[model samples]
Target: MVNGVLSPKETIWGLFSATFYTNVRANLYLTGSSSCLFLKSDHDDTYLADKEGTDYRYEKWFKNYSAIEASGMRCVKILDTYELTYSTRPDARVKGINMLRLPELYYIITEYYLSLENQDEAVKYFDKVLQSRGLTGYADRQGATLTLEKVIQERRKELICEGQYFFTQKRYNQSIYEPKSGKLYPASNDIYVFPLPENETEYRY
Candidate 1:
C-alpha cells in the first residue's frame, strides 16, 4: 500500500491524526488522568506516535513504593498498556480513546465515501467527522444520499458485537428479524442488553 501511494522509503508513520491525539490528550489532562502519559511527546507540535513503549513510567512506578505497595505500579502499568498501541512499522494502530469513543467509525466512513469518488459528499461527511469531536450522537444524515449497503458493511465491521449492531440495522430500516424464527421486531427507545450466559446462571447456586 505504501508503494502504491508513495515510494518504499516514504513510509507513513504516526498512526492517529493530530485532532484525535489532541482531543484525547486534552481529555486525559482535563480529567486529571495520566493514563496516556506513556505516549506523551517530549516536544510539542511534532509526532512521537512511532516511538517504542517507554518503560520510564514503570521504573518510576517501581521506585515510588515498596514491593507490598503495588497499587501505584498497577495504575502506571494500566497507562503503559493503554499507550502501547503502535507497532514497530506503524500501520494502523488503535487509539487510546477507542474504548469510550466511536470517532473512528465516522473517520473510516468518510474515507470510504471519498474512495467512491463522491468528492463533494465525501468532503461534507469528512468535515462532519472533523467537527464531531464536540458533537454528541450521530451526525445529521438528512438529505444525504449514501450507499446504504456499503455504509452498513462498514458499520458492521466497525461496531460488530460492540452492542450497536441492532440499533444500526434498525436505523437503516433494515430487517431485524430473528434468523431462525423469522420474526420482525420493532425498534425500542432504549438499547437492549443481552442476558448473561446460561453457564453463569447455572453456576450461581
Candidate 2:
C-alpha cells in the first residue's frame, strides 16, 4: 500500500484517462484517494531548485513527489498515455467521461452472492475482477474470506476518478469520506438528495 492507499499496477487503471484541462474555465472538486495523487505545485522550481538559501524549501516541496509516487497515481501528461495524433483536431483526445465497464458486472455478481450468504461464490466472482486487473495476489492474501467492506474498498480503488464512487456510496447508504476534514459524514437524505432545478420546479403543475 502507498500512503495507506492501495497502489497496485492494475490493468483497470488504463481503461480510462482522467485529466485536468487547464484551458477549461470551470470548477472541479477532487475528493478521496484520487485527490492525493496530484502534485502540490506545477512550477519546475518546486522540484529542481538547489540554491543555498532556498534548498530547504525545495527539499520540502520535493517530498510531495514521494507521496504522489507512493499513491501510484499515473502521470498521464508526462507519460503521454494518450496520444494526440492531430495538432489541430479537437477530437484527437482521450474522452474522460465515465461509462459502464465489464468489471461492474463482476462486482454486481459478487454482491449478489454476498447477499445470499454464499462467501465462496462471492469470492469466486470478486477474484475475477482482481485477476483481470493483475491483482490476483491481493485475492490470494485474503484466502477464502470475502466481506462487503473488502468489496467496497476494491470498488473504490478500481473506480477511482471514474465518476461512479459517489453513486456507489449513495446506493449503499455509506458514509462519505471528506479528505480535507479527514472525516466521514454519515449517510443521510440531506446529503444524498438533490433539490429539483428552479426551472423544472417553476414549470411543474
Candidate 3:
C-alpha cells in the first residue's frame, strides 16, 4: 500500500487529514495525562484490527503485559491479563507539564476503528474481559452456537460513546442525516460556529 501511494519508504498512516491530532493532543494534556507508556499483548490475534488491539488505548497495554490462557466455565480458552509496567516519573506530573508539553510525536494507526479510539477508556474496557461478564460480554459457546458475527458483536458494548458510531454506520452501510435546525430545511455549513480567536481559520482548504 505504501508503494502504491507514494515512496516505499513512506510510513503508513502517515496518511490522512491531520486536523484531529493537534486537537487530540491538546485535549489529553488539558486533562493531565501522559502519552509515554506501553502495554504488552499476549494473545495470538495480535495482528488483528488496528495493530493496537480492539482500541488505541491498549497500545501501552500491549507493551506492558503478557497474556495468559485459561479454560473457564464455557470450555473456551480465554486470554486474561491486566495492568503491567507503567513507570511515569513522579515529577512528570508537576515538573514535566511545564518544561515542554510535546505534541503527540506520531500519528497512531490500527486495524480496527476501535484501535484508533481514546486510549484511557480502551484500556478499562478490555481489562474488563478479565472479570465483567454482563449479557453483552465474553463468549461461551461451550453450550451454544456463536458464529464469527456473534463473537464480534460481543465487543460492541465496550465501544459505545467512543467516536465509533461513525465507523460502525459506515461498515454496516448505515446512513446518518444532518441534524435539523428549527426548520425542515437541512442546516448549512455557514450555520456552523466560527473558530475561536487563537484557533485555525474555519476555511476548509
Report the C-alpha lDDT of model 2 over 62-163, residue by residue, as the tens digit: 222233223322322222222222234134334333255666778899999999998778878887766654454234653446778777766765555445
Ranking by TM-score: 2, 1, 3
- Assess each prediction's global lDDT (C-alpha) against the native: 0.37, 0.49, 0.26
TM-score of each prediction: 0.26, 0.53, 0.22
Q: Candidate 3, residues 1-205: lDDT per residue as tens digits? A: 1001211222222323223323322322122234311111223242243221233322222222122311111101001111012334233112101111111111111113235544434333433441322222222213432232332333333222123334444554433442212233334433433456654555646
lDDT for model 1 comes to: 0.37
Model 1 segments beyond 4 Å from truth? 1-100, 103-146, 177-205
lDDT score, candidate 3:
0.26
* Count of backbone collisions within predicted model 2: 0
In the range 145-192, model 1's lDDT, one tens digit per residue, is: 444454454444333222456766665556554422345665553334
TM-score of 3: 0.22
Name the weakest run of 10 consecutive residues (lDDT summed) in model 1.
1-10
Off by over 4 Å in 3: 1-140, 175-205
